[model samples]
Target: MAPIVQGTGEVIVIMGVSGAGKTTIGNLLAEAAKCTFLDADDFHPDSNKEKMREGIPLSEEDRMPWLQGLCDALKERIIAGKITVLACSALRKRYREILRLSDPDHLPGRHNCSVKFVLLNVPVEVLSDRVNNRLANGEHFMPPSLLQSQLELLEIDVSEGILQVDATQNPSVIVKTIGDSLIQTKASESY
Candidate 1:
């Protein structure tokens, strides 16, 4: 991991399982902070998407390259002095570490940023229902079958600048709760 020149902005990771509302919360956080919003899914290669499309769950090996992509994107934006809020499925501690360290492509301006991870958690039933509804839309490549693997891989590192929120809660409530936490953490100092 390459340390950034100087830390100028915060990197908030909205993380959780597929239906945990990471996208919504991350987008809201980005809007409130007036920073760039990045969807981690966009970094996935067609092959990975194809795997998911075929209902084959992605292993950690499958995710490392994608995680590296995230690191690169975050590293680039951090170097350019642009704050970014990312929605990712950083399930394990290793995954989190890789991102925080900007592994693989540890650029010059990668590690010089404050990082906060927010986990959106909900009951499995709630998540299952959400995934079902999402699938009903017939657009996402993520299969409901992959949800179990994500749940199993998830390791809640609550002390690593991680905050936990109930995903099944209303969107406004979730956003407000997270916004308040961001303020309390001084992550929104520029806001």
Candidate 2:
């Protein structure tokens, strides 16, 4: 699923580098859609956070369980017919594939739910600014120190049906653009 996705639902995953505003915009998105908002960061184990706080990057091994947990949680909501927006640093294709398949109802035409990927593309300079602001206030784990690793893991898979947005744009404008797409998708569901 490189570009055009084939499933349906109100499951939208906001993804980007650490400082790309996933949680901020995701909250607005969840509010607009009247759905639950989940942050993947909360799913991280104590050790992972500790490692990042120490200015160390988490190996993929350290992230597997957390990623799986997020996938399972979202899958449960999809099963209950509940729509939600989640902030996940789904930076890799394989990681996303796991979440996309966690729903057993995802077989063939039976799955009327979708997992939309909205990628925020921010320049390194802008990401630095965001991280700087965050650190000044007390945010850790996403220190500017970890930025290189995030960019390294960041993959541009346009064929995966992702909506790529420039992170430099105003958050409200970005959310509105995606909101229109969500509205169109919901309207088609009643058919």
- Expressed as tens digits, the lDDT of each residue in 1-191 for candidate 1 is 11222346557899999999988888877777677899999999999999998989887788989998888788777666666789998999878887786423343333333666889989999888888888899857788899898898899754465789988888878877887776765634545
Judging by lDDT against the true structure, name the best candidate. Answer: 2
Measured by TM-score, how close is model 2 to the native structure?
A: 0.87
Position 16, candidate 2: lDDT:
92
**Pick by TM-score: which candidate is best?**
2
Q: What C-alpha lDDT values do all the predictions have?
A: 0.78, 0.79
Candidate 1: worst 10 consecutive residues by lDDT?
Answer: 103-112
Q: What is the model-wide C-alpha lDDT for candidate 2?
A: 0.79
